[model samples]
Target chain A: MMTTVKQAEKFAAKTLTEDGLIDFFSGIGLIAIGYFWLIDNSALSAIMPLAIVNFWKISRKRISEPRIGKVTLARGKKGNVRAGRTILIIVSLTLAVGVILWLKGGAGDVQGTWYYPLFAAGPSLFIATITFFSAIYLKCPRFFGYAGWIIAAAGITIWLGEGPARALMISGVPFLVVGLWTFAKFLSAHPKADQ
Target chain B: MALKPEALDKVIHEPARLLIMTHLYVVTDADFVYLKRATGMTAGNLSTHLTKLEGAGFVKITKSFQGKKPKTTCKLTAKGRKAFEEYRKNILEVLKT
Candidate 1:
């Protein structure tokens, strides 16, 4: 009985994020955001995750549900997933606002200070925190891996004197690679269901 | 007084159907393919069990079309949910004994 309960819970969690399409799109979005930030285009970087999230919803319906099938989880479960997403959006927007303010000279300058490196590392760390929570709440192990990778990449980039742009770009690679591979395997495993 | 052993829900007693019921109980509803994958049940076996479940009025299977492809989704009925909960209670009681 307990085993069955656990299996059902696992299924619910898997339904939250199974195909990896979100991660795939997330990776591309991160890379784009990194590029935009590198060019000092804060607006584009700010909007990228939101755009990717919208695209992921459409893509899941078009690409994933048709292949693997669909499951509408319980209301509480759905809410939990939504909450995780909302937290991510909040973090991204907060980072964007901070960056924009710093650019506008609203925050006092300290470009040469140790805090500058911390500033560059901030977004990635925030992303890592969000992903870590997602991993635990969504019960998706891949997000945990993503959280670790993002943190490591952020640290490396900062240590090497690179900015958050580099951190974001490097952080995106795993998601893209794994998402594509999972999508391919999913397509193969579940062909388009015949009428 | 000892509880009757047969008081346990026979419909959900079978392993496969129990698996299906447990899955449905956890969600609002699920499609045929998702259930198949989750349970690791063969098409024929799943179909047969679903038929039995439908006959028992424990599961409601809906057939529709998503674009050109046929879609079959299953939802546990109110009666089914009650039955499943009762079954769980019974099993827990038995285990306690």
Candidate 2:
């Protein structure tokens, strides 16, 4: 934690409006897909936006910085944990497409089987979990911070059938709100540290 | 290509401005107080650099009230972002030399 102060001070923090919104859009994009996953897969609503937001944020960082700091540049890579992420996305999309095909293929009920959701939900949820844990360790109010974890946990609960799907949706509302506040706090607390 | 040659060099030349641009580039935008803190400069000193930037039209400043408190926001102009990119390039080039 003491070392985190130097770490924190070494970098500049973005304002609630700027830094926060980037994460907010990203958070919303992920949640939107997760919600679509819960409701109907045909919506095709979440994937494009998620892809767009993620790519945009990535390009913004890489393009905006000319000779990026070694620290920040490295962190932006989102892990060359490339295989795990690619597999997660590909499998999740495949499940989504399969489920939609099933529903439209004359199976009216979209109720998912336990085994199937493990394939669809598990990987996505796991990624969120990684994000959640990292945010906690970083001592920042990143979108994947506690609020994200709480919503994500609820989503996991829903996937496991321990909680209602609505619980996941309801859990997310607070993340949308308080995540902004926490981001502001992060910025305010470190106002002079960048200098 | 993302940065104009002139703007990039301008921001690159000064160590403080280089620091300032790097900080701003990271967070997207910053305020006077945050800049002061990050740069370790006094308010007046921060203000002077800010004024120079504001005059050059690299950064845009907005003054408003956040309830009873006055809030000032400083955002990089497209011009300013170009300058930051330029600054980065110049530094890299210099280091290479």
lDDT of 2 by residue, A32-67 (tens): 655765676736644647575676566433332211
Judged by DockQ cut-offs, the docking class of candidate 1 is medium
Report the first chain's TM-score for all candidates.
0.80, 0.46
Top DockQ: which candidate number? 1
Model 2 lDDT per residue over B1-97, tens place: 3434564465346666556655655554665656665677677777787777778777887787645645567777888777777666665665673
How many Å off is the CA of A21 in candidate 2? 14
User: Against the hidden reference, what TM-scores do the models get?
Assistant: 0.78, 0.46
Complex DockQ per candidate: 0.51, 0.05
**Candidate 2 stretches greater than 4 Å from native:** A1-195, B1-12
Q: How well does candidate 2 score on lDDT at residue A125? A: 53
